[model samples]
Target chain A: MAYTKRIDGRKFNETRKMEAKVNIIKNADGSALFRFGDTIAIAAVYGPKPLHPQHLRNPEKGLLRCNYDMISFSVSERKRPGPTRRSQEISKVSEWALTPIVELEKYPNTVIDVHIIVLQANASTRCAGINAAALALANAGIPMKQLVSSVSVGKIDKKVVVDLIKEEEDYREGEGSTDIPLAFLSKSGEISLLQLDGKIRPKELDEAIKIGREASKEVYEIQKRALKAVGEEK
Target chain B: MIAEKKIIKQKVDEEREGKKKKREIAIPGEKIVSGKEYLPGDGTVREKDDIVARRFGLADISGRLVKVIPLSGIYMPRVGNIVIGRVEDVTFNGWILDLKSPYSSFLSVSECPRYIKGDLTEYYDIGDVLACKVVSVKHKSIDLTIKDRGLGKLDKGLIIHINSNKVPRVIGREGSMIKMIKDETGCEITVGQNGVVWISGSKVEDELKAKEAVLFVANKSYIEGLTDKVKKFFEGKRGGKK
Candidate 1:
């Protein structure tokens, strides 16, 4: 059922307009919400002060706890609210992607919790959540080394795509193309998270990664503006 | 010689009267030390060797001058305030709403005395404004309770966005702005710094006015002399009801 327009009317390397909001939740120590087309994620930060069970204390830097959740109505099919096995794994990877970007050493023996609520899902909700989590951490006033941003690039019908929207994913699946999601820290130019759910040629994979990096770097600007806008509003 | 003496007396009297000219503005919570008045829009000023204090309890991070007023007893949730929340959530227990602060509060259905059942989709949806009491403030989490009249799911209304830090300004001195918006628009507006504002009124136009009024107050909250601006916005408005 994929069509020529399934890849969208844009060039293969184009990405949808991305926007972000910071300090969106008044009660969150730090909070942010990110939007990429139809996908939306709201992230909140709390901690860097105390630890549970005392044994969980790091004694050095703050503990990073990340929980990824999806509302029932986020997807086309209503998902029962709670963590599935896939969500749990995604949460772990998200925490790892964010751990190094934050200056946890500045908050010794404390805990910083990152909660990501996926309000809508298109194709790259997890990656979108990663970026939102970083913004929320900064919004919570949690000292951070730098902001983390993410994007997805894939190959569809032998054509390299920078950011894949939902229809693109569907079309690629029909065409037997490769899909990969990547998250990067803009400051260090480091790849914090990489996931592949489809097949692609090795050379095509490299191109996808290159596109992902560039897209993430660009998305970083949106993250910065969101935080800055929140401050200006204050 | 008699006319010259009378003219000199009148001139001296006029000069003395001019020196005593003073304007006394109402200082609600501040103790008047020397000067009886202040310049309009003056938030921070020095007079008679005494620093005129601002009206807010928190130090002005904006570094602007504000008139001093007594802090009222009403609870106005701030952006970073560690407030108590209750379990307004049904399934997965209620997620604690941290009151737009760093600490997370719980909205656990399990915390309640009764057992909630079914798919639980309709019981407590998103943006259900519930009043919760803060129980603890550890870095681990914030404990809260919703077993009070003030705490529960909110019904239909308008949710307005405003700066959480300026919540005090929107409410005004002794709820002056809040009362005005409520009286003028005839709508009940509940503000959440998390940017979830619930405004309830039968009239759609009233709700819109209340929203605009909130955004207005939120922007100019720190500046002095805002009553007239608010009054003017409400005057001669018709169409929302029609």
Candidate 2:
């Protein structure tokens, strides 16, 4: 039973709708809220300030720290309040995804903390978190080479698709589903993050990345508009 | 020669005023301009033929230079910056000042000209606010000096904190905005590059008025006709007072 049609009727090269806003958190140095369909991610940036505990300070460059968490009420099954193993791993990967764009060398011995909270989750929460975190980092005025954009592309059976919804993720027909979440730097189109959750052939992964990169470009347009609109809004 | 220079200055000012209305804010990675004619300035980087913004702010073009004037960010400490800060800790030979910047700043007694007698705490105790000049800002160290006039202990005043990036707007062109606020409210306002402002006035009402004006300018830093708007703000306050 091959999964020929999309669960939501979206095109193979199409993504779930996305919404982005920046400077939403008042106290944070930078903050943003980004949404991909039902998944909602809010990110807050603090510092480039002095790092605590002393041990974590990087003498050569600043530290890029990320914390990603989904609220207890975000999912139907009720996520745990504290950090879990999966969230911890996501946090590490988000930090890695952000490090390429952020110029941490400018502030030596300091730490830039990015905290991401998922208010709702359907699928692709990590990608949405990265999106929000990128906006928040830019809003904080961190020196950066460029901005980052992320997308989650998956293959439902033989048909490779862009941005897999939860229903699509849960598809258990022929060949199951292969989830691939990716992040790309704006303009340069360099891959900063590439994660795979399911089995994928080398050829299929290449095609997924190609589709994901285009989808990320579209996301970049939305992110760019949101960033420009803020300083122009008076 | 002086008359000719004045005419040239006037023309420059007019050109700047005209350009303000069409000011565009550049986001990070956004290309400001292309070609060898324009040089990338602060907060901007040149990638091949294009000059893109490194910071998100107003894209300012002056002659052949392009720079992004950031609207908001933590203060990046630099040498030759006059900043206001509170004494966090009093040490043996120096004092630590919290300048609200990423880097920790220290004011050494050797840098202090008026350090003749008594303990360091006697001159600048913990929690004492001072207007100090940054003498040195190295990779791992920032040193402050109070060897000049108008740079020392702020005896009595109220402190207001704003985003460090808004300090330029509060100061304005040649201190025009600050002078306007001082004249309107009869207050002595000291704006710090680190965004800690000191306001001292004969009357509490005047001090508060000055604070309000400074905050107003900081909030609307990117707008055109800012001086005129600030004047109207003063007028509205006067009307309310009457």
Candidate 3:
């Protein structure tokens, strides 16, 4: 295989820069803003409050809902303001990824909502949104098994790379490359989310997951640091 | 029979000793003990043969019961707990009050007073702050009563909302923290179990000082030596004022 240079010159296993901050919103119970390279996402958590509408109430456990949206100007092309099919799919997957960690049964007959807004999109906005939402939920003081973190891994220029950026994603998509988005529960070392795009052999898929998990550990460290900053008064 | 009784007594003593050593931080889904050995308590649940934590908190094992004290979370309303609420709306039967919980509490007109009952709004209009006790709670509806002594219609005071879970910290162990704040600031402070705080002082400076102290505790509740830190803060403020 010929050597192909990455757009940002990152190594195959190297991840993009990650920055996280918790408690950015005062009114919301918990809030976090996270940046992965150039992509940025903000998440706010509300509730563990009574679930509205009598029919929606679950007698035994709390309901966890997530809404993922991208602002019109977030991408190069102006996107719509409201929820799109892509956004809806992201929202559903994000909720599924987070549900395993939250102690929903502890707050029975209630609801916990996570709202994530993508301010910028390079690539892997869903993964960034997941990270932000997990931090926001933790900041809100919602009980959880542990912080959840995620990263996108893809085959770019015949090389597997962690945390792909926009150009790499586009480049890979054009060439029928494979992209895998994975989320991990740091404490339990379990995969809560895994979405694969395009086709990859079993060996490559395993390698991608292994790399994604390792990158999520770095993300988990950043999340813990952000929570610590908010938990203690400096 | 005597030997059997002695063996049972020894087992109970061992369980108590085990409980003392079992206290530690727990995360959700982490197993604390076996269900056969201990009954699941607050912040914990039984799953199969194990008792697991339901939230991030401290696991408290006492004899045959295991519970967890949550580090932080929304306030779950309970009967007989005093709470500070703001009247949000006027209903025919009662007034809807925001107790800062997920569920809004209701203060029925009947719970207000026995006599003087023309219009309930006239007695407690919208946006009126009151200190009341939770009489009962069913599902999402909570019933409150202000008929008790030192409860009802907060007229003049600064109301600050903090996380309800930290209310215990603000009150401190044996009411020591609240007592210290009141004595040092010379302000009357009432902490609602629902996380609402009312502070009233003859002087505006004193009220502000007390508010600051309460906010400080809420913000830094996770820190160790909090009592001493609060005391030092009050002392510094007094010296600066002089």
Candidate 4:
């Protein structure tokens, strides 16, 4: 049977509820918390300070280093506490997603580190992590061209949708699940990150990109508000 | 869709300016003001007929210039700025000073007020704190000088740290806030541009009060009527002592 309706009783294009807040980690240069329904991610930013290891230093520009890890208890299935292969891959991708916006050339030989921790996982943990990382960078007052927002959008059994929660991701009927996580730059609306798992046709991928791009604008709105909220108290 | 985005942007800008009478907060890539009428200042960048914020900060618009006062960030060194640094190493020719920045600075013997007779440690020993001037910030190293007046090794007292961004408020307008703190607590206070503060007073109690006052100003740097509030705070503290 065709997937005519959302299993969760939501609109096809609707994302899960989201909340964003900034300055959560006091000692960190910058920090933020972002929640996408059941999935939650917290990120902290440090430096534009010196980078260790003589080889890693770039005299022409600075480096953007990211670490993404899910806590052991974040998922029902136990996750290893250390940097697993999956976490390492996500960390590298997160750096690429964030690097487009940072004015790296201004801080030559320094490194800005972004640490993203997934506290809870339903689905789209990387989505939440990327969103939190962007907010934390802005909170750190690192000069950036714009913010980055991410969302997962693809076919859950042959239907293009935005922000698939766990129930939707588990769909086993028809064409099965195709998860595509996408990141968009707030200013240029450019695609900085795009990753897909499972099978998808070229035409179906087009539909997913269209839906994901629009969904990311909502994430950008929340992130901007969170960054501006503290200063608005004045 | 692009045209529609422009309309939405116009609407948002209108709503922002309408509520903003004083103290507007700027977000990264957010337009501080549209049009070439305003020149972009520090913490801001120019973007196609609009002045945009490059950092998260307070939007300060005055006359023809628009700048953002950053609320948070590590200190970026600049030439001609006075900073407090701890002498990390007494080198063969100079002392390597830690300015709390990523880069370690050098204070050479030539930069000192007196000619070195013996070892460099004889002048400024390792582990000593000094208020020095930034003579140069080059690609490989930063240079410092102690020959400038009121810039030299600091003696015993207290050293407090605050965000470098709030150093302007700690000093106040024309040295007003710092002057008040010095007069009230009878402390010799030096506000460093790199956020390190040195306070030396006759009594330990006075030194602590001065430190508290400086922190108070740093904490409330964005608020209006800040000087008056600080004065009231001082009055209350003095009464508590009595």
Candidate 5:
């Protein structure tokens, strides 16, 4: 199978360059802006404080609330105004990714709200958001067992690709184009969140995991540099 | 990409000045770029990715700040601080509000002069918008007032929740954005990053337009010159000049 793309002569294994800035908002306990290729996500972390009565609160551990919002102009076509059902579902999945890494037991009966705003939607933004949010939490000085880093693996033309930019994502076929997004606790080497949106053979699936793991090393470096710069600024 | 390029440039500079710069003990095969390089007296707890002295233990990579210690406690509400809230209970005495803060506040009935003596139930019912004020806080109880003309129930408007910390950004330097929102929509909009917003206007469309405008500001709070964009939106709408 052949695939056509909008990008000019970009390779299948290439990843968009990514960089992140921490403490972008001085007022937030932690904040970060991450850019991967054209995808941009800004995340902020607040609290370890009391949860409102309206929101369900866990008695044994702290509650983590995540909201993923994209501006109407984030993509080439304007997204429908207001948070869509898809956004809510993504927000829920994001919390799952961070729950294992965060030391929620340390802040019992409190809440930590993570808000991610997508400024651009070139590709793999959910993964980008997860990475940015972990940095923001660390920047805020929140206690967490380890940082969570994420990457995407997909199959194109029957060959697997490490990170799928927008053009590759668009050209991907329904059944064969497999994409698996995984979040890892860099310290524990544990998978906190995993999602698969396409079909793949059993062997192919294992290959996807290996690809994701290796790509995570790069993401982990990005997170470390971002945090190190934040520490230096302080 | 820019960040990585900069890192490379920094490394090259550091290597050129290599004065045997105190090599902290490192794990033989542990990845270097992502490892946490901690100096002595750094108090952070070690995690796996952290690169620390070998004697610190193979598994210990967390760093703790030795000097900077922050005491955690209840968050106090400050005047001019934006908050998010809900109307919990209403009374002849006042409306009890939940601000998601450690303290809850009350909005006095007298302060709401526009609320006629009729069904009080009809004008502003329970769970109405809580854009009132914190007149006082004593013994963990808060006294609230909505006496100002724009401070009542939100008839029809949009409510946005910004980072309670970024309220200042939404407000801009010297009360600019808030002032523009008022001038543009001819509607009253209240912001409480503590997460309550009250908007009221005779026209639902106008109130909604005001909400959209405010949300626009909230989304791009980081960008420069947001006031112009909001003003343009208002101009495009107000005169039917589209």
Candidate 6:
């Protein structure tokens, strides 16, 4: 468990390079492109419009649905097109992460659909997807409690690290590695998403959460700036 | 920029005194008011004793009532609002119109002009544009009528779709914006409340200029002195005439 520098030359508590833009898709109600290091994700939001399949309409609040997909060439090896079980689970988790922030009661009986497409994958695609989706929702002008920001933290070489890349993710599968992805409502400081893989002690978990929280705050500032840029344009 | 800073400083001072400010942008889930002193309205929700904003919008307070005016969103169809729609489907009894809202509107045979005696398709076929009014909206269904004046088939006009919320800005204060475009470009323009705009001019240049002016209004609607800016923009294209 010797201390070793990350492959990307980032500090143990440091995250990867991040870039985000809003209103990138013309036809969609709202859209955003988000990049964290080498990983990139694009999200588009449609509706709060009428829900299809008459029976699925909720009398009280609108339904929020998410679909997470990875392009065939996103990975080093070509991925098969279409939804797999992994994508389905990620979609459900993304939907759960976003639903709490949306004010669904305002658009009762309608459906808000969020589509997240990963154009590149080095790691932390889900976290990047959540960030993009939040921007898209804001760009779409959907009513919500606040924008959500997320980051993935993990233990590598017996040290806590923020924003894991693909190589770090692979390392987590062996021996003593843990991956924790966390999301929060930036304005309210409320935790909207938390997922863990592998094993980590309570002390490490606390440390990971603290690092993730700080990283998410930085991401939230970027989200606000992107929204303001689009607002100023209008 | 100095004047803008002064205005912002004055607003901050007013806010410190607990006076309700006008046109403050509110982010989603941000608390607008506490206790039962204010009642929540549009773009806001009542959570226990607190009224919180439900979206990104401007806070509008009228006496004890508090509401949020959303800056962006899709058009929610309302009764009696005039909308421009494209015929999507031709049915036996009616034509399904895409009003650009979440819901499709129905223009039934009964609602069509009584003068039409033959097949409905022959009168208003698919892909035709129509200016219609929302006669009724019930649940998921929206009923439209085209029998009134200027509420029938639109022929050979350039259609421009904008943000539904910007429809008001396009029309401007007391119809000033629309009138300005019409006078300058000499194009017949019909703006639908649902964010659909139709422009037809005697010349191609006039049509393009009208489109350009409407888009400029939509883009710079939030800025001050937009009417004068728009006039300058149109005149600049016409060799600075007037």
Strongest candidate by DockQ: 2
Q: Write the per-residue lDDT of candidate 3 for residues B17-121, one digit (tens) a residue.
A: 654573465645568887465688886778888898766556777766888776566888899999999999999888999987877789888897656567777
Give the alpha carbon lDDT tens digit for every residue of B1-242 in model 6.
89876775665555556654536666666778775656899888898888888777677766557798777789988888999999999888899999887777999988977666668889889999999999998876899998898889999969999988999889999999999999998899999999999999999889998999999999887777899999889778887544
Q: What DockQ would candidate 1 receive versus the native complex?
A: 0.02
- Candidate 4 lDDT for residue B174: 94
- Number of clashing residue pairs in every model? 31, 0, 0, 0, 26, 2
Tens digits of per-residue lDDT for model 4 on A1-234?
889898778899999999999999999999999999899999999998888986999999999999999999999999878989999999999999999999999888899999999999999999899999999998998998888999999797778999998877888899988889999999999998899899999999999999898999899899988977887654
The reply for model 2, stretches above 4 Å from the true place, is B1-21
Q: Highest lDDT: give the candidate number.
A: 4
Native-referenced TM-scores of chain A, all candidate models: 0.93, 0.98, 0.95, 0.97, 0.92, 0.96
As a whole number from 0 to 100, the lDDT of residue A149 in candidate 4 is 90
Give candidate 4's root-mean-square deviation (CA, Å).
4.8
- Candidate 1 TM-score, true structure as reference: 0.52
| Candidates' C-alpha lDDT | 0.65, 0.89, 0.84, 0.90, 0.66, 0.86
Looking at candidate 1 chain B, the ten consecutive residues that score lowest on lDDT are B55-64
Worst-scoring 10-residue span by lDDT in model 2 chain B:
B12-21
What does candidate 3's lDDT look like per residue over A102-181, in tens digits? 87876778899999999999989999999999988876778776678989998764677899887776673334466788
Segments of candidate 1 deviating more than 4 angstroms: A1-6, A172-175, B1-242
Compose the digit string of candidate 1's lDDT tens values, residues A149-211: 898887777677877787667763455666687988765688999888777878888888888
Residue by residue across A128-176, what tens digits does model 2's lDDT show?
Answer: 9999999999899888888999999998889899999998998888888
Arranged by DockQ, best first: 2, 4, 6, 3, 5, 1
Q: What are the per-residue Cα lDDT tens digits for candidate 6 across A20-106?
A: 998899889989999898999999999977788989988788999999999999999999999999999999999999988888887
When sorted by TM-score, best at the front, the candidate numbers are 2, 4, 6, 3, 5, 1
